[model samples]
Target: MLRKFSSLILIILFFTTNLFAQEKPEVQIGGALRFNYNLSSWKEGQKTRGGDFGYDVFRVNAKAKYKGVKLNAEYRLYSEGFGGGMLKQGWVGYDFSPENNLQIGLTQVPFGITQYNSHNWFFGINYYVGLEDDHDMGIKYTHNDENWMYAIAFFKNAEELRFGSASDVSDSRYSYDVSSSADGLYRNKEVNQVNLKVARKFASGNSKHMLGVSAQYGGLYNLDTEKTGDSYAIAAHYELNAGNFNLKVQATKYKMNPENPADQDSEGLAMTAYGAPYLVASEATTYTIGPAYSVPVEWGPISNLQFYNDFGYMNKANDMYEDSFMNTTGVLVTAGNVYTYVDLAQGKDHPWVGPAWTNGLAAGTPDAEWETRFNINIGYYF
Candidate 1:
């Protein structure tokens, strides 16, 4: 499958370049390779550390505009075990007016913050709940002007394009199983999802502010268990940029309701958390705040640097489950198109926030109190 996909992409690129060479359509190719060295401290047992070097992403992006019609496509190559080559985004659209257009393809869902609302590479807790940086097979209509921006999309399948087997019982990491047999309510398998977002921008002196609201609702059905799942989220976000300093904040309330709650294990509802096993929670509310300061310095091979901090907190409705929170402080150094990150992170009960030792810990484990990690990541973009 990977070989076939790679061949297809090469063919597309070949045809696009040769066929449109005379037209002089815009074409750009770029990607990034990231290396990580990580150290962890666990609350119990032994501490662990490791290092990995690989290409984080290799993508080909092409865009062309002729007359009033526009076409865009992006293909990404994933390393072993993740998947092979896949279509990250591909769309064709036409501009009816200056401020309005329509696009159809496998694209990003209009929910939460579009470009990610976190300073850290791992993002915030909302990402685990399918509210961050999620893409779907859908058609979207967008309108943008000086003051207001609006988007609405209808998705047929949340994440069905990746490598996976059609069988429900397939345990392959890339399988299409919507819900885990051990837990219910935490999944991105919802179909026919309707997502919408609207935002307004305001400028004040040297500061620019953007405030937005987003909502999503979807339905899920498990053919194996003959059960159903319903998911929805309501969120508000605010961003402010003043001089070299910027601040971003978001709050979200979400719910996942299962038709046959009895099928769930003793842990109750399963919620997705980065780097951590499925979190057990009925309903959840989460908030994230990030502030960053950037400074431009003249130095050989270094153009700018940024210092930032990200804080996130999550509260679960179930009393049996304790609250979770994460804090990350990092410095991002940019030299030309390359970026380096030096970070120290600490948290409890969440995967990316905590040490590596706590990953895959069963629910209600006493040793899952707190963990810490220090990481250095170097990435070069082309």
Candidate 2:
């Protein structure tokens, strides 16, 4: 299947470029192929079965630029059962100048951290709550200089997979978001969101640092009430690099209020991802810290190794809910276009960490014990 698709794409590209009558912009196509191995503490049966190893993802990325206009897009294919395939991102942008730019379409939201808030495959608790590495249908403006970087965006909402489906729940995309499901766990939809992020980049001797603050607010449109509620989050973050060592820290507070119908609960939300939905506390405070060091290596086929430990914690504003925690100790090996990550990840009250697929981010189960997963992911990028 893949070979046929690749050949067809190449054949089309060959003809499309030749058919152009005028000078063309630069176009680049690239992608990555990856696989993963996993063993979990919670899955006693899996241990008896010698763990699971399988295909991960094959993705394509495309970029082009013509004068001041640019485009970027990515599409991904995964294994048969889980998160089969989706459009990760697609955006069009115009560079007003070297220091200013604008983007429209499905682009990353300008909130919390710019690209990522975690160094591991399993991201921080904030990610489960829809604050990190999130993309939406929006327009954004950005400014950058030697000492300052700033961006603001107005998102209509998360990218919709279906326009008029009878069911509102959808987990067919890349990022996690709160929406109503067939189970009727939630009824609020994200809409009219705005985000602001500002940062200062500076250096002190051999150390480089970045300090930033981010905030976002939006309407939570209730499907049942036909009335709009609201949600908001504020965050502060800092990063430091001294020689080969790096440090990252972030703190965030968020709240959600939905005009839920009388029968529904307003203190909780259902966040969807990976073809499933789970509950999350509507109000919480989250914190994450990560530190990493690099070691240059002369080993065969290996250029460098990065050792890191990341820790994240979430404290729910509702006293009835349990706190959530996650920690990852990992090493990344980089060899040219090949990269590998070996991680020992532990979590308490995390949905991904357990065998039961419980909604740990919301009310949480009683006596929630820690669960662990040993994971290795290898990818080759071109």
Best-fitting candidate, measured by TM-score? 2
lDDT of 2: 0.87
Local accuracy of candidate 1 as per-residue lDDT tens digits, 1-382: 9999999999999999887666545555566666766666753332432543445556677776765567787776655544556666677788889899888776777887767778776666666556777666778898989899899999886445343542232222221223443332333345678989999999999999999999988866544455657778899999889999989899998776655435444333333221123443546788999999999988999888899999888777666666677788998999998899888887777655564322221233445666677778788877
TM-score of each: 0.79, 0.92
Error of 1 at 245 (Å): 1.3
Candidate 2: tens digits of C-alpha lDDT, residues 1-382: 9999999999999998787645568899999999999999988888999889989899999999986689999988986565678778899999999999999999998887668887887777788888988988989999988899999999998878777623484676778887876477577678999999999999999999999999999998877778899999999999898999999899999999988888887778877766777788889999999999999998988999999999999999989988889899999999999999999999998988775354689888778899999999999999
TM-score of 1: 0.79
lDDT of each: 0.67, 0.87
